[model samples]
Each structure stands twice: as C-alpha cells, then as structure tokens.
Target: MTRYWVRAFLSGLALSAATAMLTVTASADKLFGAMEKAYVTNPTLNAARAGQRATDELVPQALSGWRPTISVFGEVSRTRSSKEGVPIITPDGPDVDSVAINNATSGNVSIQLSQPLFRGFGTVNQTKSAEARVDAGKQNLLATEQQVLFDVVQAYMDVYAGRQYVVLRRQDVSALEAQVKAARDRFAVGEITRTDVAQAQARLAESQSFLVNAQTDLARAVASYVQMVGQEPGKLSYPKVVSIPNSLKMALDVAGEINPQLLAQAFVEVARNSDISVAFSNLLPSADLVASAAGSDPDFAQSKDRSSAVQVGAQLTIPLYEAGAVYSQVRQAKQLASQSRIQVIEVARAVRQAVASSWNAYVGLAQIIKNTRTQVSAAQLALNGVQQEYQAGTRTTLDVLDAQRDLVQAQVLQVTAERNRVVSGYQLLAAIGHLTAVEVGLKVPIYDPDANYKRVRNKWIGTDVKTVE
Candidate 1:
C-alpha cells in the first residue's frame, strides 16, 4: 500500500508541474518586455536627450571668448591707384601712361595673434549665463524623463485594467452560459417557462457585448503602450497592488523643492539675471591684444624696401556712447530679469497647487478603497445567502439573479477603487518631484547631465581645444 501511494503522489506532482509549465508558457509573450522597449525606442524621451546634449555646447562656446585667437593671413594682388603718382611713361618717358600698374604680388605672411587681455565682467557674466542655461537644460531633461515615466505608468495601469475587465466579463459570460444550461434543463422538466431560458440567453448576449467593450479597451490601451514603449503588449499578469503614502505634507514638500519643471523655471530666472550682469559688463572697457603685419610694394616696379609695413599692439575699446542702444539693452536686460523672477514666482505657486491637488486625490482615494472593501464583503455575503435560498427553493430565480448581478457590479467597483487608489499614490509621489525610474522599478541607463557640464566647463578654451593659440 505504501508503494502504491508513493507512485500516485509522484504522478500527481508531475501532472501539476506540467500544467503550471503550460500556463507559464502561454503567458510568456507579453509585458515582460515593456521596459526593454521603453529604454530602446522611446522617441519623445530620446528627442529630449538630444536637446540636452545640444544645450551643453553653450558652455564651450562661452569659454571660447576667454582664449587666444591666431590667424596666418597673406594675399597676392595687382592694383593701380587713380591717385597722382611719380611721373611715368612707356618708352617715350613722358607722363602719358600715368596709371601705374605695379605687379604687387608679394608674399606677405605673418601669423598674428589676439588674446583678450581684460573685459570688465562680460566673459564672467556670459560664462555664468551659459552655466545657468546648462543647469536649466539638465532640469528640462529631468522633467522630460518624469513625464515619460508617468506616461509609462499610466499606460501600464490602463493595460492591466483592461485585461482585468476582460477576465471579469469572461467570468460573467461563463456564469450566464451556466444559467442558460440550467434553465434549459429545468424547462424540459416543466419546472421553468420558456421565458426564463430566453431571459438567460439575453443576459448572455449582454455579457457578450461587455466582452466586446473590454476587448476594445484592451486594444486601445495596448496601442498607446506600444506607441510609447515601441513594443506590443501581450498577455500580462499584474499583481494586485496598493499605493500608500506615509505622509501627505512630506510628499508635497519634497516635490515642491525638487520637481524638475520647477527647478528648470528657477534656472531660467538665474540665467536671465546673469544677462543683467552681462549687459552691465558692456558699459565697461574691453581690452584685447591687436596685431597686424603687411608688406606693401609702393613701387614693385622699383624695389621692395620702400613700402612694407607691420604693426603689432594691444587695442583697448572704451564704451563712450551709442545712440542709446547700449542703454536700451541695459533696460531690456533688467526687464527680462524682472519677468523671469515673476515667472519663477508663478511656477512656484502652480507647483504648490499641484501638490495640494495630488495630496487630496491620494487621501480621497484611500477613503474610497476602505469603503469599497466593505461593500465588496457585504455583497459577497448577500450573494451567498441568496444562492442558499435559491437552492432551498425559498428565493425566486429573479431574486437570485439580481443578487448575483449586484455582487458582480460590486466587485467591478472594487477593482476600479483599487486601481484609482494606486494611481493616486503615483500621482502624489510624482507631484513631490521624487518620481524616478528606480522608484518605479524600471531598468534604464541612468542619464548623467552633470557629466557634460564638468567636462566642458573646465576644459573648453577658445573655439577649438586643439587649435593653436
């Protein structure tokens, strides 16, 4: 007997394992690859990345003005001046051919160099402005990433919801099919009327319509996910999840301080304020080393010692006056600075409002979840009692069916409540500016925006780093 029992147990285990393996295989081709698609082919997010890289060039461009510039210039030419010159003639030796056309093609080449000796503060201000813009670009990249994360989360949840609804509707259809069978069997025994079976058929048809709607929703959600992530959403098994916030005020506070969009706006204000300094710098003198070398043939027809001239010195430019264009620029810079400040204030206010709203939603949805749980429990108990009464012949068919429908609807509401609660949690975290790819368990190559800044801010000199100064 022990040997027989051992063999039966082994057989049962093998059968169970096979069934599980089949189920796993059947469900394999879906959501397991969503993150891969997101990291690889998300166009909107990639475009933002490219923008960030482009903005990083400003740092190098600003640093170039601080470095030396050198040029090796030469020219070959033949020219005749209309001005009166020494009397000349062809062979007659009079002044008839007065126009002098000296073959002035002389090799005059000198490598001249100009370096900025000093600027009031223009270089400093411009560098600061560029740095600020780089900071802003980093923030913009962060904001773009956050937006993409939200889109992925929202799309993922939508797909999960559609799938769940499909299952729920399928269950309802199955239950209706069972009811139709029971009704038909009862009618053959004369215990039920033809109307009852017809009613059951109609209910099945209604459930079929619901199935169609659920499938339609699933298709749309899948399309959106595929567009965002660059892969198709197949079958997925999403865990029943909860989003719980530890503290609303804490979340709100964190988001207001770190939110990328808010930071980006603040950086813009800083950049524009730096522009004010740049404008002020224009009012100060600019000192630059100026050098020029030229060898001119006064009379190439005669000798080379008469006309070659070379000059090398520093040029200092002092801003004296400009029909008010410089002053107008100063005013404009100040106005822009003021506008930027106002924008920061406005964006801060808007951030706070968003925080408050998300906080409220999180709290409200938590309450709804609690209430829905109670409703689901009560509905389930009521459904059990109605089924018991129906089997005992104390409840009418209509009464039993009504209870079942109510229970199903209650369960559906419970699903929606859970979904909303978790989504609200995501929204709360997102509002506080703490939404990261890691927080959502996404595996992506982390983007390092500061790396670019560090690389160019210190090393960029002149227009080209390798150019001879």
Candidate 2:
C-alpha cells in the first residue's frame, strides 16, 4: 500500500507541472497588447491629453476679441420725504405757508451692447498665436504617448529577461546540489577525498545565494511591469524586432521633420513670433461700436413720470503715451521670440543625438547577442565533456564545477544581450518619432488630439465640457 501511494504521488506532481506549463503557454502576453493597455489607461498620457484640451480653449478665448458683448442693468429704490413751514406766492394773491409729506418708489433699467470694430489687428495676431500654441500642444501629446509606449517596452523586456535569469540560477543550484550529493557518495566509498565533497558543498551554497538574488531582481522587474502596463505581468513572450531607419543620416532627417519634441519647439517659435505682433498692436489705435437703451420712472404713483432714451455711438482709443509700458512689453516679446527660436535649434540637436545613440546601441547589441549565443553553445559542450571526463576518472571534481559555472555565465550573458537588444530597438523607434500607437500597429483607438480642439475651437456659447475616459 505504501509503494502504491508513492507512485500516485509522483504521478500527481507530474500532472500539476504539465498543467502549469499549459496555462502559461495559453496566456502568454504579447508586447503590443501591453502597449495598447498603457496607451489607453496610462495616467501620465491621459493627463497630457487633458492639458492639450485646456490649451485648445485658448483659441476661442483669443477669438472672443472679435465678438460682441451684451449686458443688462436694473435697479429699484423707495424714497420718503416730509416738509414743514413752506411759503408760496401766487400771481394775484398774498404769500401762504403750507406743510407737506410725500412718499415715492422709483425704478430704472438699461441694456447696453458693444461690438469691436477694430483692435489694431491684435485679434488676428492673437488668434494666430493661439492656433500655433494648440499645434504645439498636439505635438507634446504625441511625445508623451511615445514615451509611455517605450516605457512599457522596457518594462516588458526587463521582466522577460529577469525570469530567464531566475530560471538559469535555479538550474545552477539544482545541478550543484546533485554534484554535492554525488561527491559525498563517492567519498563514502573512498573514491573521492573529503576535500572534493567540501568543494561541491561550497559551490552549492554559492549558487543558492545567486538564485536568491536572481529571484529578488525578478520581483522588482515584475513590479515595474505592473506600473507601466497597469496590470500584473503573466508569461511574457519574446517581442519581435521593430523596424528602424536604414541609415544614420536618414534617421536624422526623419527626426528633424517629425520628431515630436523638435516639432513642438518649432511651433512654439511660430507662436512667439505672433506674440511680438500682438504686443506691438497694443500701441496702435482701437475702435468699437456701442449702443444702449435706458428707461427710468421718477415716481411710481404718476404714470406720465416714466422716461426712456436710446443712444448709438462709436468709440475710439489711441495709445499716445502709456508710461513706456507698451514699448517695454514689445521689447520683452521680441526677446521671448528670440529665446524660442534658439530652443527649436536646441531641441533638434537633442533629438538627433538620441537617434544616433539608440541606433548605435541597438546595432552593437545585435552583434553581442550573436557572439553570446555562440559562447553559450561552446560552454555547454565543454561542461558536458568535463562531466564525462570526471566520471571516467581523467578529470578532477574542480574541472566539472568550473565548466558548469562558465556555462551558466555564458547563458546569463546571452539573456541580457537579447533583452538589451530588444529594448534598444524600440528606443530607436521612439527617437525617430515612430513609437506611437498608430505607428506601432496597436489595436487600440488612436487618440486624436485634434478632436477636442475642433469641438471647442469655434464654440460660441455654453460651459459644458466633454469628459475623457
């Protein structure tokens, strides 16, 4: 009965392991799926979209300068009075004294309308500046999206490589454990010395320590994966390589034209130039057409005491002197425009540097991965040979241990090189402004930054705002 129970227990363990393997194979997470989740749910990216919507409101605010404003005013008041010892003289009678008391209620109401006729072209320049700013905000949103996706890629690769390392370390510990057992068994028969058994035990202890550290590293990587992708990581499959630019020059050219950061700064420079015009317009003349209708009742008891008036007029304002404030503002705007222009050049240079660095790292890792794979294969063959030689009594116990350690090292290097290569490929795509939802073929609804802008650009009334999910 005991022997039968032992066989049943062994079978159950095998079944459980097979089940776990099947589950992992069935639910392996792909890179694009994680990216899609991050694109839709990432807090940072959503905040950026909200900011762009706020920037879009600037356009309608600027356009308000060309619209008419209407206002209504009203008031009501009660008055009471008492008089004593008043003298009155008639045309053909003597003077007389009289006392009088009176009480009255009065009310007034007015409506005024003013429409801007001309604002020294400030309205036009302000509108242009606002639109340019909106464009810049759109580019900024794109940059944020790229960054979030790249982060997801990095976290995914780290977790994948980390899992591999943990598995390798665990295997090393198991192998060392078996070697320690075998060395003791050999020593019991006097085939190996006590020193050989001690060496095997020491190696096993060292490998167990390494396995603990590898597990800790994997836990950290899993935490980062959750933060980036907004969910706990499952079995992650290896990601395929993304497309990259053909040459360094081509990458630089592409980044110069479409890299979101550089384009955003270029738009900022345009907005700054428009700002100069807006500031200079403050020194020019402005005109407005004004109209008003007013009515008032002097006494509530008298029907004929009500009076009404209507007026229409044009107002003009010319800034002859303003204590040099407007001139100072114009100079300040010019300086800001110069600063923005310089910023555009600075951003372009930075984008070019990122592209070049990512490209080189990606290329270098590819070669390293190839070499490490060869090294792993060679080390595995050497370990196998050494173990056989030790069994045949031609090699020392230390020879087999050294060979096993070298194999593990080579395998770990290969895993790290592959992980870095995948990450650098995505990094290169991001640098060239291609690592976006639409560009990466994510099966998610691409966020249209222009949608909210269009909805609010020409809005004339109402305070309702659309909510984002």
Candidate 3:
C-alpha cells in the first residue's frame, strides 16, 4: 500500500514539473500591445508632444518678419480756449470783457501696412534659425519617446526576473519540505536522531521565508511597471526573452554615432550654428517698404472735410554700435556650438565603454547560466546518492540534509543567472539607442515629426509672400 501511494506521489510531482517547463501565460495581453497602449495613452508622452507643437510656432513667428504687417490706429483730443469780443480795444480794455470757450476735438483712423524689402538677409537667417530649432525640438521629442520605451523594457525585465526568483524559491521550499518529512520518517524508524529532523525543519522554515521575500519583490516589480507603462498589469507577462544583438562589432559601430539622444545633441550644434548666422545678419543694414494711407484734412479744425492719399517709400535702418552687444551674442552662440560638439564626443566615448562592458557582461552571464545548470544537475545527483546511502545505513541524515541544501543553492544560482542574462540583453539594446516603439514591435500610433510644423507653415500670408530665397 505504501509503495502504491509513493508511486502516485512521484507521478504527481512529475506532472507538476512538466507544467512548469511549458510557457505559462498569466497575462492575457500581449507584451507589445500593452506597451503600445502605454505609449499612446501616457500623459507624460502627450505632454512632450504638446511641447513640440509649442516649439513649432516659432517658425511662423520668424517667417512673419518676411511678410507685411498691417494695423488700424486712432486718437482723440479736447482743448479749452479764452477769447475777447473787442478786437480793436487796448489789451487792458479787452481783458475787461474776456470770456472762456470750451472746444472738443477728435481723431483720425486708417489702416497702415509695411512690407519688408530687404533685411540684410537677417530675416532669412532668422527663418533658418527657427528651422533648426524646430529640428531640435522634434529630436527632443524623439528622445523623450526613447526614454519611455526604455522604461517599458525595464519594467518588463523586472517582472520577468522577479517571476523566475519566485518560481525557484518555491522549488527550494518544496524540496526542503520533502527533506524534513524524510528526516522525520527516518527518526521514527530509529535510523536518525531528533536533531536531524530539527535541522531539516529549520532549513525548511528559512526557505519559506525566502519565498515570502520573493513575493514582495514581485509586487514591487508590478508597481514599477504600472508607473512607467501607465496601467495596472492585469495580464502581465514576458513571453519572449530579449536576445542579444549579433555582437559588439555591430554595437560599437552604432553606439554613439546613432543613438537617438546623442544624435539629437548633434543637431543642437546645427541649431547653434544657425543662431550665429542670425546674429551676424543683425550687424547689417535692413530696408523695408513703409507706406501709409488715410482720408483726412491737414487741419483738424476744418468741418466735414476729408481727403485721402497714399505714400510709399523705403525705410532703412543700419546698426552703428550697441556697446558690443551683437558681438557678445555671436561669441556666446559660437561657444555653445563648440560645447555641443564636445558633448557629442563625450557621449560617444561613454556609449562605447558601455557597449563593450554590457556586451561582455551579457555574454559572461550566459556562460555562467550554462555552468550553473550543470552544477545543479551534479548536486541533484549527489543528493540522490546520499539518500541511497542513508537508506543503506551508510550515511547520516545530516549528510543527506547538507546535500539537499547544496542542490537548492545551485538551482537558485542557475535561475538567477538566467534572469540576469535577459536583463543584460535589455541594457545593451538600450545602450545602442535602437529601443523605440517601432523597434520593440509595439503597435502604437506614431506621433508625426512634422505635424506641428506643417500645421503652422500652411497658413495665410500676403499674396506676394512667396518663399523669397
């Protein structure tokens, strides 16, 4: 009867092991889909989009300099006067009959238009500067997106690693429980002392505590995922492990030169250069067509008399000196451009270092996992041999317990190494700047890069407001 029950128990354990080996889908939502929803629905990313749009408005504002400006203006005035009727009398006699008269006067109103003819190419340079800024803002938006994608990848990795820890700890707890039961059985049969059972019980309790800690880690990982991805992970799962890229060769080739953040910083230099052009143009003469028209008499005191005429002429302005303000600005912009170039170099060096280290770490951890798996298998074999010896009265219960502990420790290490391998793969991908919504296979809607620019540029301008190159 005991043999029959033992066979049934062993069969049940085998089925459980088989179930664990299969892909468990605790989450109903696909990984990429959840990430997509997070990308489009995240408030933080939306705010970034808003900032980009705000930056795009500068293009039209600068372009306005090349277009005509019109305005309608008016003003009113009242005056008080004193008069005497006896014009032929002496000044003292006329003062005896003086009287005060109050008169109210009014205003004039007309539309005024002034159009730019030439600005020493200042306006052109300004338009180019705005264009560069728009490019920078667009790239900044991309950087924000890259950061969000990195957060998602990190959250996914955390959950995956945490789940592995939980599963391995549970296995350890189960093995220790079995050992304790075996020790108790041996004690009752006079094959071992009470001390053996006590030791087994103590180890089992420690393993159970470790399981609780694993649960805590799982909870924290879930919270971080929710914070980053903007929703509670109901069907959270990491079905596919992130794989390392071909090798460090591909990574080193692309790390700093192509990383999104670094690429954006490079464009910043272009923007600063554009600013220098704008500043240089400020030192030159500017000319515009100044015109005015109105229906009015020369004397406002005239009654019901209105005359209208138009005048047009060029208004020129030349900058003589400004306490070295313009030169100072040019110097500042040039220095900043130089600083940006240096930053690109610095970032490139940093990324190169990270790529080398992360790649090696990833490959190293992968090898560690393979070796640790072998260790686990060997420890299991040793534990089995010791168990057989205990049954044959050639091994103490203490010896069997130590072998079981070794096996559990080896299994834990193997699980950890596997988790680390996947996490390191994520870190390496992020370091390369290829981690984005589209790159990660998220099905999210892409925010258009030129959306705001097009919206502002495609608007009303005067008939002659062609792009005067």
Q: Which is the leading candidate under lDDT?
A: 2
For each candidate, the alpha-carbon lDDT, in order, equals 0.74, 0.91, 0.76
TM-score of each: 0.76, 0.88, 0.78
Clashes of each: 1, 0, 1
Each prediction's RMSD to truth: 12.1, 9.4, 11.9
Query: Which segments of candidate 1 are over 4 A away from where they belong?
Result: 1-41, 78-111, 177-203, 239-245, 296-308, 384-401, 438-444, 458-469
Sort all candidates by lDDT, best to worst: 2, 3, 1
Q: Model 1, 217-310: lDDT tens per residue? A: 9889877876677555556655334343567677667777788778988899999988988888878899998776666554446674545557
Off by over 4 Å in 2: 1-25, 84-101, 186-199
So what's the TM-score on candidate 3?
0.78
Task: Mark the 10 consecutive residues where model 1 has the least summed lDDT.
Answer: 460-469
**What stretches of model 3 exceed 4 Å from their correct place?**
1-28, 77-105, 177-202, 234-238, 241-245, 295-302, 305-309, 390-401, 458-469
Better of 2 and 3 by TM-score: 2
Best by TM-score: 2
**Shift of residue 405 alpha carbon in model 3, Å:** 3.8
Clashing pairs in 1: 255-432
**Order by TM-score, highest first:** 2, 3, 1
lDDT tens per residue, model 2, 1-469: 9999999987975675556445554588999999999998888999899899999999999999999999999999999897876555568664456666689999999999999999989999999999999999999999999999999998999899999999999999999999999899889999889999999998999999999999999889877876777667777899988889889899889988889999899999999999999999999999999999999998889979899999999999998999999999999999999999999888988998999999999999989999999999999999999999999989888998999999999999999999998999999898899998888899998889888888998999999997776
Measure candidate 1: CA RMSD. Answer: 12.1
